[model samples]
Target: MSFDEDNSPFGAGVPSDVYQTSIREPVSLEVPEDVNPEAVQPNTSIENESPVNTPPNGPPLADWSSGISIIEAGKSTEGASRGYIAYTIKLGENTVRRRYSEFESLRSILSQIFPLLLIPPIPGKSFNLKLLATPPPNGVDTETKLVEQRKKMLQLFLKECLKMEQVRDTQVFHRFLDPNSNFNEDLRTGEITDLPLNPLCSNPFNGLDTYKNILYSYLPPEVHTTSMDLESLHLQQEDNTKQTSLYEYISLYTHIISSADLSFSHDFDKANKKVSTTARKLTDYYTQCGNSFNSFSLSEPGTELSLLLERIGTSYDQVYLIEEGFIEFIEKRFNDYWKFYLQCFGTIRDVLAFRELKGRQCEYIRSSLASKETAWQAFQKSDDESQRLTQAIRKSEGVASKHRLLLEPSLDVRFVPITVPNPPSKKKGAFSYSLSAFSKLKSTIADVITLQPELSREEQTAQLQTQINVLRQCLILAESDISKMDEFINEQFHLYHDEKLVFMRGLLREYCRHLVEVNEKCAEVWLETKAEIEGLGL
Candidate 1:
């Protein structure tokens, strides 16, 4: 198979003879209790076609429905004899059969169409090990369970597709729903087409700005203002701080575990070396004791002494054997086990950490949006109050009370340095202006409009809005990343389990080997002891 720049599949298209759509009544094939319906099936035809229903104002909707039933029990290409699910998919008025892989292909295409979405995880097509290892008496039921699982997963895949309007309304999706249609073939031939994008949804994958705009487009117009109140900004700042906590937790876990793995590995290796060294030294000591016994003469007392020394040397040899066993079984075996153990630990830790990391990123997105929304509302409310106060002053037509103009509004006011003109009449005490001065005050207040606060509010609002957008993009990116991680896990799950299987096999092999070696060594030791006793004439 070949792939396009977008990683879409393009290869040998389905044969022209197989291009026909299948339409038939829903067919049901009973599956046995022991065999999984998802195990296998021959590519059987149930072809038909129906007209597409075009709506007056929206995209054309195809009357697609789906059903699943067990098909004939047969040997799958994988050589497993199991029942197959005859998934009946209805597009318009036509129905046909499909395999689970078809469902996977459909999901893959939809993922490309909506890159930002978390395409729900799919069950891997490979057989579960339990099913493969089941005894014949119990095999059928395990297969049945697997089949059921696959059915549910396939259903979930379809359900998720229906949830997304972009996917559900697409002609290509309907074609996929059509059991007779070769969706993969269409993809290979580049005949697959997507429905028009929703007006509110910009191509999220295009760039950061587009992604941000897509999020903004979802907000209500009333709370869409670019202004923010100081109070709301403060609240948002608190939430932003809260978002960091998850990050810190993830970082701490990764750092600690990674460091611990290295340190523990070193310590374990050191312990192994010590055990091996002890084993070697003990063996040498036993050898020296045996050599010392050889120097004894064959006189009665000498012979007795030599025999006693030989017995002691034999007991020491047993001890030496035990020491060697410790090195071989405990030290060397554990060393090998620790390598894979650390690998497994790291894999599990990374998965968990990545999950938490995504969760933190999601929280940040939610909080940022919430803060922006709150600030926008507050700014609107504050703006409304200011406008109302200005309107009241204007309505008074220059006769409003000084206290009412300056105090009745109940605004948070701050004093700033302003140059005051000296009174022309040289009035003592406070030089007070008439009500006309209040008019200029009103215009001046209106002109500046809380100049510093306004500017600060605007800048904060802009910053919040931008963060909101970036965070939203991050959220989508998180979904994409986590989904990829899930796929990786699924793809490697069998290998992961196989690691355990391999370990168990190695353990069994080691046990057998040690058992045989111990048996042979005991025979050798017994034979030598018997020979020495005979030669001593004891």
Candidate 2:
């Protein structure tokens, strides 16, 4: 899970060039050199062009320096009598207010539009449904804390989205940040709506126009098997000597991340709870010690001992303040970081699942093509056999007719009388009479109703041929799609691992910094307390 240089999960011995060569050129985000930047409006749709709103001269880019942030959160006063929490988001100069549900909608829309990409996860509405339903006595305080937590997490979500080049350049991402834009309306009449219901069966790059591509239309509706099943099937194909297929690579990566997630969850959860509990207890203990010292000082007023007691009380109060601040820091940094990390894992899993589905779609099309081709071959054989039988029968009939004509011309015919045969007597059985009536009724119904003629061999063969053609075309498209998807996923896989490394480094650095700062501050407080005791000559 740790992607340190020496212990990289991706083969450390493998040359970087191998990965670089395997990857296809990424979808360019630059505007074409031939296109006039000035003429390009904000909403213009151009291939290979960045969708982010930018000045005419500059390439469209996300400004991470003045990154997206949730600046504030408060109870909504607009629209309804029942107020809900709304978060005020700030992206550079632009500011917009959105509710949690709106954020959820934005994520959903982004995911649909870029189904192959890893969209960042947002905070859930409620962590504990029971707790939410039954608010504590200090419900206002709890609500405030929840709002603060969401503000932090939502800001992280936005930042994570911006970090992704594809996600950052989307108009949807920009609109979510725009103050005047109606995101809900945009979603209603957006590219997401135009995309196929099953994105796996469509072209990921140009999903809205997938209908125009007949090949994509012929793709199977959905993958019948789960991603895990696909992974298991490909597990045996993996070997150290050869480069694994993209699907196999994704499967391996997914399993690794899952294992890492489980380990991290167990260890981090235990550590976080331990630290939180310790901080709280220390704070309580300091409060009690401070109270005792203060009481002793009050009892020994007007003496040096009283002043010393008050100094000790003040030191305990300082420690109490430090511990309280530490608790808040732990909650914001450690707890929230773990939650966000888990969400990242979830997002990665989703992206991998999408890749698996695409692989399955390709497999389905290929199998279908094979089956169709086999059927077409069978139809051809049957048609050929029928044609030979038809020709032989016609030839025999012609020969017989010629012989009969020759014989008639050569010989005079003689007439002969034959004895007539009597008909058999009918049995008067009730069963026989009923069977006869049923048979006559069946005959009458058959004469009244006309059955559709079965397709002739030629017709059946032609139909099979048509299907074969379609499946072949579908297989071609599916193979092409899978190839492109693999390239994309391969690139994304490297990018994700690189990002993970950076994120992990940052997390470790932040943790160290927080601990160092807290320890240093606590040491200074104790040193001051020691100095005060020395000044009293105790």
Candidate 3:
């Protein structure tokens, strides 16, 4: 499948085949031999559509206005020999089946395609690793619990993706939900491959843009520093008198979220697991107490006391059932929610890491330019010295030529080789010293000329200047990228914070509501028991 300039599978003005209204239902897991898969279509009639109810103080419901649901999950009949489960997704009247690996691919592609956006996490492959490693015997349905959990989490994943406009509008996303569309084929030849191998080195908004890719390529290779290393560096920078740039500040923020004292994932995991463990213990105690009361009541069979004890035992049973529901709620809502945010922490770190790399790229370019400039200056000094030496040698030659001309005109006046026989031994004088110095100077100039680079000094200077100019351009682009990234990350952080607050508010509200319900039912049970005891006149 080919993507257009806008990254849509269909070119501009071509309406997508995907239905505008999203509603889904699960069909039978077993595909019939005679049934045509292409014939199945989601109902798009307006009358059949139902309004969506959004919770108060929650995220905006626009993205989820068109609901996506996982109707059922079962082993694929076509792949029965290998035995992998497939989840049936329904949106409006449209339905499609996808495997866990497909969901993995989808998320991977989305992250690369939109690195700046927050991509939701899916249940890891480890969740069903056992089932995959050893498929059940034919017709056997083992690991139903794992499959059920995956279905719930995957459904949540789709809904979360729908909440983001950028994610929902993507052609790949729509194709994944299109029953007739070949999603795997599209994935193989998708626009994502056209992007730079490093997602950070591509346009955040449009990775396929060649011009943007070229500019981004100027960025330095990604730094492989660990979180601890980054944290240490950040602290060192903080200690300096110089103010931290936005990128450094973001790095520090992400480090704190992922690894520091303010780590949400770490704290949430600890708290959530503690709650689950405590609930399990409470349920176990209730079970034991209920059994004990029942056993004791049997000794007083047919007595009013026996009935009273039985009633009390029944209350314990009721409370146990309520607690069991509460446990399920915690697992589904709180535990899963924590896992989602944990994945988000990873994504946040990756984004900040990209920014860090870009910042480093800028630094690298500046350093390169500085070194080039220094080399150029040194070359200029040498060139100037060479010029002065050449001018001095020419002046000396001109004086020698003038003397030769005058001597040639007086050739007849002749001469003599008269030598002062007993001339005092010539003392080392200024004239001799000057002659020695001139000889040394001539050699120095010769060495300078001979030791010159293969390229002329002018050419060498031009080359260095060229390199400096390229580095300067790269620095400009790197800085621009960093600035854009900073703004985008900041905006996303705010959005994430808002969503987190809404999610936590809803979570706590539901938790309290469930607790109130359990208490109310328990109170009614005890009140009935009291009324019965009074009726017995005990």
Clashes of each: 10, 0, 9
Worst 10 residues of 1 by lDDT: 221-230
lDDT of 3 by residue, 1-538 (tens): 3343332323331223111112223111112233322333221111212133332333333544467789998877565467677899976655789988889778766766676677877887764445644666752344766687788889888887888776655667766776776777775565544655555456655454533334455444343232333432232233352224443656655564656334444665577567679778988998999999999899999988898888888878987887789899887666666556556655665565555555554555666668777887888788889889989999999999999988885545478778878968868999999999999999999988888654665665665666555556656665655555556666677677677647766876886787678778768877887897788888
- Residue 43's lDDT in candidate 3: 19
- lDDT values of the candidates? 0.47, 0.65, 0.63
Candidate 2 TM-score, true structure as reference: 0.76
Q: Over the stretch 50-80, how does candidate 1's per-residue lDDT look in tens digits? A: 2333423323342322332333322233323
Superposed by TM-score, candidate 3 places the C-alpha of residue 275 at a distance from the truth, in angstroms, of 4.6
Q: What's model 3's TM-score?
A: 0.67
Candidate 3 achieves a global lDDT of 0.63
Q: Judging by TM-score against the true structure, name the best candidate.
A: 2
Each prediction's TM-score versus the true structure: 0.34, 0.76, 0.67
Models ranked on lDDT: 2, 3, 1
> Worst lDDT window (10 residues) for model 3?
41-50
- Runs of candidate 3 exceeding 4 Å displacement: 1-66, 77-81, 132-142, 210-213, 222-278, 281-313, 398-461
Which segments of candidate 2 are over 4 A away from where they belong? 1-61, 77-81, 127-137, 209-212, 227-252, 409-457
Which of the predicted structures, 1 or 3, would earn the higher lDDT when compared with the native? 3
lDDT of 1 at 390: 89
